[model samples]
Target: MFDIQEELKKLPDKPGVYIMKDANGIVIYVGKAVVLKNRVRQYFHQSANHPPKVQAMVAKISEFEYIITDSEVEALMLECNLIKKYKPKYNILLKDDKHYPYIKVTMNEEYPRILKTRRVEKDGAKYFGPYSSGFAVNDAIDTLKKLFPIKTCNRKLPNDIGKFRPCLNYHLKKCLGPCQGEVNKNEYHEMMRKICSFLSGQYDEILNDLKAQMEEAAEQLEFEKAAQIRNKISSMTQLSEKQKVLSTDGQDRDVIGFSRDATDLCIQVFFVRNGRVIGREHYIFEGEGDEEIGYSLSTFIKQFYNNVQFIPSEIVIQNEIEDSETISQWLTEKRGHKVSIRVPVRGELVRLVKMVSQNAEVSLKLFKDRLKRVDNVNEEGINQLMKLLELEQRPRRIEAYDISNTGSSEIVASMVVFIDGKPARQEYRKFKMKSVEQQNDYASMQETLYRRLSRAKKEKEENIEKPKFSDLPDLILVDGGFGHVSAAQQIADEFEYRLVIAGMAKDSRHRTKSLVYNGKEYELSAYMPLLRLITEIQDETHRVAVDYNRTLRAKRYTHSELDEIEGVGETRKKALLKHFKSLAAIKKADIAQLMEVQGINEKVAIKIYNYFRNK
Candidate 1:
């Protein structure tokens, strides 16, 4: 077993990253510390002063590891990288994984193709945007195409340049007909350069160039070409006039606003590039009602920029953050220039913040109503349960528990959460029944409920980020008869946990039959909505518990013999097993076949080859 105290004693006082792992050796949290010794030791020695979430995390931290970095900035960078790789349970993550649309110019190809895409790759292609709206990006692309007669096809240019005839786009003067060799390389390259300039927001330069082309075409007596150039210039001018100019100083800035209710917080950002508003994006964070605006902004800034490609010169906000200087330095380094974080109290900037805040407020109100409608389907059940059981609250957040085990081995308890009458799957949690080693469902139920509610009480009292079980449930339901309900209620009473406790009883066929509350049984009629909701919760709880137990049992059953091999860690072992799909295939495989698995380099392949051969 790893000695946590001994490891704490040996920690170096340096800037670094610390990874906290649970008893199962799974990384549950990753953080960076300016002073490694002081920061890491706080989790063990002065945990009472830490937040409830941090303390709960500390309780499960059986071991921790650290990597020293040269500076605090480097430590911060490393922390972001590790969080992305491991996706620790306690960290604040970017909820949306959808990539915004960008205008991609295929500069690597002979005849470049301009198209709209969501992915940005490093292949010598020029990308513009990360536009919030796909329609807006498409509109921009369409305008560019009308202005410049560029090819928008998948033809193999230069190889079959003159092999195929021109299409309708060529007849309509929408394309330069590169496939028909109508436009030379130099002329096509010039037009592409102009398109690039236009996409770069150099509208004045593109307009002047178009005017010069129109005059030249007119002098050559090409009235058709002159008319096309004149039309392009007119369209470009109209688009330029449509842009809303907030300032003429050409400063790049981002205006931030905050809004929230009791359950959710919404943050809206207006991306102002070159003094014009380009686009806006809103992000929603759960459970930030009591959080300080400054702290929330700090967390939002870090997580927001973790994946963002563009960093503005200035960020204007309504409140000041605690680590504004550090974040500014980080942003400055990211953008290769100075980046300012300003909290404006007066003047034009304040007005901008107010405008953004109004937008945020509207967005939050609309989003919250939408989310409430999604949960209102179960609202009647929640209300009915509260009234029937004489509960203290509306049972908006109900938690159902079930214990699953196979002959006392790999025993576990699942806590399925339902918030606002709907299942909050992300908030559901599972416990491994630490205290109760045997297959005693009542004892396991008591221990799990006590542990869960105690942590929730601490978190609620301490005003910490109540992640998952840390948030107190309005009602608790255990899967069993009266015995389970009594056990859970006793635990709650002993811990002073403020929650209504009940139990679900099963019929002869092992299906949900009724609710057991306060030593009384309430039958669940098949047609009742309340009964249907409770039945669904009970079934989900049982399935979650059984699935978790099965996973644990399967891991114990597959204790691979390859684990004894030297230099073969869990990653490599899994890689080899995945490639061969079984031990028998691995034993019969050669070095080349072993090397076929990614991350299994030649040296490791030879080691595995030699080990199986020697055996």
Candidate 2:
């Protein structure tokens, strides 16, 4: 129904983003174009030369969609968001999609606190570092705490002062005890200023000040105070030495470098703050050998910077990338200052880029070696599994199902997937049993399978795009004996879906015992690889099912009748609970008594009274 030529003709002349989807409606590629009509037409033109990757993507394009934007910048923004959301197959994706931790100084409070967080918000707080890991952030915080006696508790200072006894931290000299009103406001603010300076990589000034104080304390014959200052000086020295200085300009920047082989690419990024290299991280991309270095590097920049909490003032790379100017503009907007994307031609920066690229090459080699070992183990498991089940082909994708419940409530089923002997976590799905009211595992299994397969059948018949259930697995596994397997097979038969369907049987101790298929139990104890694979699948399916059941039970336990009232929100609910002491008392209270609660007006009181009276 989707004519490529006709759709190409309909593309507008304005800038926009285009999405290419396959027959099953899975987005294969996403691109931005300054002029939609001209750019989109080039893909379908037979005379146009295209890379092998693009050719493969085009061969699978069954339909396409486009969104017009006001400017090319807007299109680029949308393209980044869409690529992050869908992670299209043909796009270069950063495998390590992690938001590194940051150290936050809550300057917005009357008495500030230093804490570790992953989010950077505009709340009048100063943030430092997208540190390599939580450990790194904790290390920095721990060092600061050792040097400064700042408060760590969440008590509202100045108001909560003198209301409660100082905590153990104050007695141990770990905190300044502002809650006890023992600390001067001016002195505390000055200490916070020094802490901020230390985090900004200004070590020499703080070190000199600490040394001077140590000598002054010794001169005054305060030996213990002088010893403490000496220890603080030592700690500061150690921390500063950990951050190796790379430049004298004291500017923040990121150095990105990559190394590629025939099939794999590794990108390494060095985070430099105040001209010091704080940390480095590496990302691996598979099957990108044919992609241009510029294109891959450009895509990596957009995806990486999009999710991070902080954007550096400069980005240094080994080569010039596609749309460098536009990417710089986007980064500049995000950073609230001018950002530069530079390709170093000579000097120290060029040397730094080469060093990062060397690290990336070493990482790629180690990764490939480890991957080869894992692949061998997985391939053997698959081969053994196919032989055990008499399957015609290797079960590249195996879907395992399990049913879980507590009594007759919150009956749920889970489907876990394993592709090529590794768990495919994104494909795992859970279902809450809708039709089965009682605790019947057979009926629950049947309903789960029926709903799952029905969706697949509907998508296949209608050629639906953005399908919920895409392709059926090559093998079906149920975490039970013969009955569960029989129920699942009945649903599969109704849809004429043919594949190996089996159950994972357990021994007396509930450990994986054998595979039950075609009314026969296949012993797996003699084959360790196959047994381990089956056990993993069975355990994962059970964990998913049980976790869902527990979540539903927790929700039901937390449910309050007051939540059903139209005008009662969390604040009013808390107020009612606090005033009445119990739900039973609230039910018995008159409308006037209910109105006495804060934020609860006469209308809400009447509604609550009527609801309880009717019930």
Candidate 3:
């Protein structure tokens, strides 16, 4: 019923978010357009000119929707929110969104606690990250804990300050024992302030502050305090001396570089804070093979900054994206300062970009090599598994099932497909557990398997050409023991389908222990390739299931937070979240920014502003 040409006629030439839905009314892709009319019409008008992915997406577009925004930046943010919410199939999905952790300092608390977290909440706390990975974040936190006596405990301070005795951390000199009221509040706060300065690359300022405090303490005859400050100054000065200064200008910049193979692209971002390379991160993603570097890099910039808080004054890339000026303007607004986007073709900046690109190339090559090794191991595992289980044929196609949830609220299941020992990611699917929603894993697994196999059977019977469900897996693995295998068997019996079902059993330490099948347990061998392959599959399925469940839980949590506010519906909530990027951002937003969002007016904006303020 949706006419493409008719909708094209009504399209306005403004910035907006666009949604493309398939025949089943499921959103397959989401994008932002600077000129809605020109952008939307281009797809329908010149379908042949688009890349294959776009062409295929267009071919399946049963309907499309758009929401106008005040600026292209707003559209860009809205597009990210929509893509995250729907997880449109064709969009470039960042699977590791929550994988990178941040070092969060609870500055608002009376006694601040520095911890590692992936979630960023707006509780007046300071967060530094999207670190290389969780390990890196943990390492940073550990180092900070060693360098500074900031509290790592979760005890309620001031109220419970003198209630408990000091713990082992105090004995080890790792903590100042704020819980036992051994440290002055002002002095502890000063330590936290110094830690902030250290994180922000104010090394000289910290040293100067420590030196001044040390001299003051010495003059006052407080030798203990003076000695402590002297030690800190020495440590900080040594750390600064160790840092390799890349530029004398003392400016913050991010060097962006990338390399691509036939199927995947690797991007390396070098974080230069105050001209010193503090850290670097590499990202790997599927590529369209023939994509122009400009488009790919541009899309990356938009999505990368969506979650990052630190926007550098300069972003140097090797190639120019189409909307450099607009992106610069957006970054400037985000950072509340002027931001420059430059494509350095020569000189020092160019060399820096090229260095990052070389790093990216090395990273991509290593990743691909590791992937090749994994594939080989998986192939060998399949062969060994066939021999061990006495199976008739190798499981060239294997399916894995895992159920994950936090208690009973967001029970979900993931089904991942492995073809020839490698992930056939496109064929993987996720299911929300509906039949048994409580903490019953057995019932959840049974329901998920029944639904999946039943649907596969129906599709096989119904479709003759390219029958998607007909190409069933040779083996099915469940993330449980005998109970799950039995459940799968019951479904197989009911459906009159022959299935080779195996359960992955974990040891007391929660490590993959063995394969349980047919009332027999095959103990995992450390040297066996089969064990590693099964562990990999199990880990992957668990990750997928947990991620999906987390997404659902987040959506529910976000809905509950906004749904209670008067005059805010689904559309308005989306608009606010998209425009502000996060609930914390929305909470911090003034009435003007709130009003600038698509569906919000002055009255609603004031209401929202007051709501967060009062809360």
Candidate 4:
């Protein structure tokens, strides 16, 4: 282990970089910061100011390494990159695989078609929404079909384009006669154009024209056209009935309304086009922040549209943003037309915003209520963590750390986040060991915490992100009994602040142990659900980290020794290792059964068969 305090003294106060290593000299973490001195020095602070776990992390600082940076923003960008590359244990990692699905309507086609998609690809199609509920999209599609009569089958019109016979949809009157061509091509195209216009945020004009035509057709003895228009009118009427109308005038406008409790934010945007509420959307963001509800709403809308390719003509804001004029100008220029940003002042617009606000409020309340019995993590938990840390307020979510290394080789750390009184699995992190030389828990903890907290600070200083604790955490739980907590404490003290730190002391069996608060310890069993929850968190975090550690170790071991030949991935390697119970047995097995493992494909089986055939 290296001398950590001495290393901290040597760290440049100017903004730059920092590196952390474990007992075996393996680089467990890497990060950049604006102020190296204050950031690096916080690890050796008082235990009372930290959660028992964090206090334990602080105690374990064997060594720390740091570099300087010119500004916090640069540090932030650099930090995100490094964390991504190394995958440190403690981080607010943005999940990369999942995506929101949207409904796309290609209005430009001669006959517009609706499609389901997970992303709004730039194929010149109009995107309706990122509906989180599959049932919602299904229902909307069904309802829309009733009004528009889009073809539900894969048949073409009478030109033999692909028509076989009229499908059930035609019999059910839910589809225009594309199959039999009882409907003229021109008339069908006209219907498609009308649907296209409605989907493209121009419903009022389409509705009005249909009404006028319906009246004129009835007078001109065109009963069929009049009946068709009448059906369209009825469908539109039913849709309008389901909607909570926000406005009635023909103002091509869009309104954004939102609500947020201390830990979550929900925004509802009503798409009011031509004086009627045509369509709408809702979004929820759960993360760290300090902005009040109104300000949060403002920031959200701004960031949201910053990435938006389409800017509506008129945007009705629920609250004022500081750079409204600038943003409005930018949007107007992009739109190639005039754009107005307004916070409605006591008219129909205000009434609309209020309605949206009420809806958002209800949505948030519903969400909170749904999560109520799950785990009650409130301000008190945050305060309790904060007060214990000797800081200002309790942290709403606390991130804890511990590095698990079998020796100098399999170094890794587990990061577990406790939100309210429960764990937020979405926020948990795992770090694979990197460029460090040896195994050292103290140094590893130091580096992991340094990277996590410093990056958080960089976000705040640069205005790209608010302070993590700005939303704050209640406590930081460290995996080790004492060393990890002490290292965390030192880091806090150096920052010249108090944060509740605690150590999760594990038993000799490496199972659920107890908590060390201040200079004393308490059994985890006394906490019941909380204790059980913590154990699960601790166990999960440990498994995640150690599993990664083993993976890396195996990767190295396989490439260097066991997997000296071709035809080996994780699963194949596992089968060979397990069935034979050793590399030697696998090397000894004949080709006939060498290909018998579950995942071993024929080609791979042959390769394995051949390699070990001569072994």
Candidate 5:
């Protein structure tokens, strides 16, 4: 038996992280402190004043654990990671887990290519703009291509020179045709430098160069060349005009502002680069109205920067955070330069901050209004569903299951979840049939339910932390008629898991027709809200199942006998296929012929030859 009092006494008088857990061993809250002994002991003190959120969390605390760190900075880092991993209930979280798009200049290559990517890696390439809009990134890349005759092909540059004819891009005058060695290396690299400068919001230099080229072309009486140059200059001018200039310092910074209502909090961030406001994004945190603005803003900064591809040199916010200095140190280390977190009291920065905050307020109100409309529709749907099925209470969490297969092969099932009439995509689960060998939908449904219920039972009994299966749904809906409902109910009964089980019956056209419950068909045509809700659930479940089945079939089709051989991975496999044209041709090839394929060494060639000969 674990005692909270004993664990509290054992906390060391050092900087570290503390995790509070409930009786079920689930982490309810995670925090960091300068002194573990002092911080951890404060929660258990009867006379200590605490906020409502902290008080509620403390009441649920059954046990606590601590990890000592060398300094408060290390503790903060560890706390950020833990909060991200566990998403503790008490910690204010940034719920927008978006991986923004970036424009990558592949400077690592001999002939660099400009591309849009979602990931930023340390590959000696320059990246620009973790842009909020993919369409904007695409437009920018398209415009850059028009402005520069850079190559778009993936040829191995100097090595692949003269190996193939110039592609259509070169014929269309969109590329410099480096594959054919038409452009000098130094000249092509000079153009790439101009492209990089343009991406960095340095438009004046490129515009002047374009104007000079146009003037020279016209002086030489080359009307077509001068026309193209004029067009390029026009494009660049329009692109530069789109960026709203905010400062003359040419510094990259982010302006963060927030607004809170009775129940919702919205944090808006403006991305400013090179004195221009490139883009803005807003994050919504529900049920944070009671949280202090400074504390919430601090937590938002830590969580937001943790996953971002780039960190700006300065972060301007409306309020002073308690850990501003510590967060600045962390961000500076991340950015590999000096970073400052500022709360402006006077100047244009203060005005900018206020503008961002006002935008946040407007965004919050609009979001809440939209949410209210959605909530009303969802409530009507739930109420109608309750009346139709005679459910005692609202079914807040509904799980639906469907099975898919190709004849008697590759049987799969999908479990999709809907919470409060909204799809909870993260909670979805997929399973490959283990016991059932044939294309039997009823048997497959039973196996899926049995496995799911068994896991739920095990999770509850073992007190699993961050349990996925233990959270039983308030209702279960299977995609079929009476037979599927009976199969699911049988398993639910075996596990003694009491919940309403129904079947979504579909017509011949694969449209939802009715709901089967208690061996009776409940037509949903009269209840439009319930019908739409059930149809959405049924379609989503079927789509997930079919997608899983298609993925499995694709894998099976892509597999080859070459996969079984050692030292022949995807690259070598493709090489062999391209060289021999077919598996039959590969089998006929001798060791000498096998060695003709690139990446096929003598040892691997012998292994392939021997294996085929033995077969």
Candidate 6:
């Protein structure tokens, strides 16, 4: 095993890449850093000032590797490229891998159609940005359609001289009347040229032309045409001026960036396609971290581009990164064309970089705020459980099981997953105590826990590469005070997995009074809330097992008043259960609401309404 602190000490302050390898030397995380000394060292520090989530990541890191770069910008560039190549597990990544939209112009035909494209390819087509906001891009498309109305359909016009109607757009003064043979080669070509210039942001000429057209139409007594032209000009001017934000004068390039606070993170990205702010979107991240602004941008860029098919030609960034060459290399290789990255010092581009940095700061702050309570678990209690059970690691999600039986008949087991301080009911499981041969109390507990833990261990071994809730527990909370705890301990010890085994003991009044663990009894009732929580969890688990046993005895059938209605079977029964979760919820569900479930169709809904109405 490699010494982690020694590896941390070897990290240089220069810009570079770092890889976090597990005990097996599997690369779990790969990151680029402008200041290796600061970033790498932060992970090793034992400061209670850190967020619990960050602390958790630090605890899991066993070994690491690094490569120093000359400049921070180089580090940024390299980090993004590496992230794309090796998708790290612990990184603030873009979820739902989608590239921003691009304005694509294809050279596949003499007459090219301008369209919004998600994927960029090598079929002789020029592509613009990967837009973050689909709504904004759609708005741009709507505006373009109103202004120019290029062929919206994917069908190519037959080159056989005269085929197909120009459609409704030709008569509406939308399309250049291309269908009526009214537009000559020169006239139609001129419209495309004007569109090219307008989209490219040389809008001074567009305003001038619209003004001239409005004036000419008004003088010729064409008031409607003049009004139409005037409205188009006004819309164009307002659209250009709306996003008159921080650095609008530069050559069009999408500014993609992300930020995090405590609770959640948001990645704010904008598409500056053809020098216009055409699209923008923000992706919400649920984790917390303390990585610098540049490193975040690099990580996001790599992760974003890894799954997305397109890359812009010029990516201007907040941090001039060290990994610039590598990222550019990877992107160029992907796009089959060269891409460049720059960190400007003085011009509008530099201001744009600063603006992006500011956005990241805002985003990170939001992330931090949300996570302040999410993963703030009771480490002492968890560690105590871990030590008592003799487990390998602290359990993030623990499940405790107990068997309940009415003599030898209604034997069932209840399983619950404790997430942080609360019960994660979604992960709660139940099983019937089958194959136990006899209905002995100790044997029943052993049977139930053995089945649960054995299955969990098998899952952990099978999915050793991936950590999941199926792994063995940190602690097992048996329902009985002492007898159940003793029974559970033996099974865990038999499997050679250290686990904390405890039981919630209740007084004669069914009130939780003490916890029995490893042959000792400790009163827990003094902590009213903790005691109450434990009792509720224990009761819920017991109830769950009893209910499962009842259902198993019932055997593949559930009788409900809802099922008495026509057209209601297992599907509708389950639907009613899911919608309502209980009989009370079903009673509250009105006819109108009941009709909302799909299979209710029409006749069934009416029957359900009357049945409930009469009942």
For model 3, how does the per-residue alpha-carbon lDDT over 410-446 read when each residue is reduced to its tens digit? 9899999999888899888999978785898888888
The Cα local distance difference test for each model comes to 0.80, 0.88, 0.81, 0.64, 0.88, 0.67
Per-residue CA lDDT of model 2 for 426-462, tens digit only, reads 9999999999999998999999999999888889889
lDDT of 4 by residue, 1-615 (tens): 476766667777687667666566654556555578876666565434543333444444456666566665455445545655665432323333234455667655444567666665667776754444466566666667878778665333334544476677777777775656566766776776666566444567878987999999999999998998898788776655544455555566778887864334678777665466655666765531112445455445444554444556889978886546655765676567988889988877888899888888888778656654554544333344343435565455667776888777777887777666566877777766565548888778777766666666667678773344333345777887776789888877765556678887775445555777687766543233344445556766777787878888877765723465566766678877777787777667666667676776778767776776666
**In candidate 4, which residue ranges exceed 4 Å CA deviation?**
1-98, 153-190, 213-231, 241-364, 371-615
Ranked candidates (TM-score, high to low): 2, 5, 1, 3, 6, 4
- How many clashing pairs in candidate 6? 42
Q: Write down the TM-score for model 5.
A: 0.60
> 136, model 5: CA deviation in Å?
1.6
Error of 1 at 334 (Å): 5.0
Report the Cα lDDT for candidate 1. Answer: 0.80
Q: Give the least accurate 10-residue stretch of model 1, judged by summed lDDT.
A: 523-532
Poorly placed runs, candidate 3 (over 4 Å) = 1-3, 46-48, 105-113, 119-126, 148-151, 154-162, 171-173, 177-190, 202-245, 331-339, 345-347, 374-615
Q: Summing lDDT over every window of 10 consecutive residues in candidate 6, give the lowest-scoring window.
A: 524-533
Which is superior by lDDT, 3 or 5?
Answer: 5
Give the higher-lDDT candidate: 1 or 6.
1
User: Per-residue lDDT tens digits of candidate 1, residues 260-344?
Assistant: 6533578898877667676789887654433456867876787677677767789998778877887788889987889999999
The full ranking of all candidates by lDDT, starting with the best, is: 2, 5, 3, 1, 6, 4
Model 1, residue 310: C-alpha shift (Å): 4.0
Task: Count steric clashes of candidate 5.
Answer: 0
| Predicted structure 6, TM vs. truth | 0.49
Backbone clash numbers for all candidates listed? 0, 0, 0, 90, 0, 42
In TM-score terms, candidate 4 sits at 0.42
Off by over 4 Å in 1: 1-7, 23-25, 43-63, 106-112, 119-125, 155-160, 184-190, 202-244, 251-254, 292-295, 311-319, 322-351, 376-615
Clashes of 2: 0
Off by over 4 Å in 2: 220-222, 375-615
TM-score of 3: 0.52
